[model samples]
Target: MTTEFSPRLFERDSEIRALGEGLLACALPREAWTHEAHLGACLWLLSERPDIDVDAEIGGIIRRFNESVGGVNDDTQGYHDSITRAYVAGVRLFLSETTATSLVERVNAMLLSDVGRRDWPLRFYSRELLFSVPARRGFVEPDRMPLPVAHK
Candidate 1:
């Protein structure tokens, strides 16, 4: 990723990480997970006018949410899992309406550009396409991509 694009992705990830850490530090019950904390974070990020400070706001929310419930694990594993799930859901919700074609185009461009860089091997990702898009000529060849294994 270029400096510009990487910052956006990192910003999103960092916000989620801080929120998770705050949750782990606070005394909260599992009920805290249902408090719409993830939605709040997503709304703030995607809002038209983001007045609140990112880290401080997310941390405060997580802490308060935890305080509302009984405290749970305050360690890396707990925080990491919560953050990952929240981030994945947020991305899916946020990007739902975006066209698959656009996603494919931008991703291909990014990959092609990065592939030529010395740092190419350091970055890797795989995503299973759960939905099908009509194949378009000159865009991508479905035959060239491996299909995801069928889940029983």
Candidate 2:
């Protein structure tokens, strides 16, 4: 979880589109799976690929992609349900709030905002709670503050 982070994820709209395409195809490189890339993928999928249900299918998509990249999805490792849900919801909300003409512009704006922080979740969940086994295994209510997006 202490991975190096970049404030900016993409330089162009095509990069974001590529991220979404790579994610769905499970061809995204291991190193390319950064926090910004995660959010960027949400942008593309939600904004462009209306055929795919981003929130409903994100977990399986991420799990499959993780496995394709030789990663594990156990409680402490690959995917964390609550964190991913929060981010996807945040990205959804961001899209709803912004009027950016392109995906990359929206992603860049997000990178410059609080959501860009690697510790963005900490604003809603306690560190201990967010990284706990339950949070990793499935979605759990935040112990700190409510997420901006109303989530089940």
User: Could you say which candidate leads in TM-score?
Assistant: 2
lDDT of 1 by residue, 59-140 (tens): 4444455445654434321222223233333333444433433433322232234322323222221122111222110112
- Give the best candidate by lDDT: 2
lDDT of 1: 0.35
Q: Candidate 2 clash total?
A: 0
The alpha-carbon deviation from the true structure for residue 84 of candidate 2, after best TM-score superposition, in angstroms, is 0.5
- How many pairs of residues collide in each model? 6, 0
lDDT of 2: 0.84
lDDT of 2 by residue, 56-147 (tens): 89899999999999999997899899998888767777777776877789889877666767788888999999999999988998888888
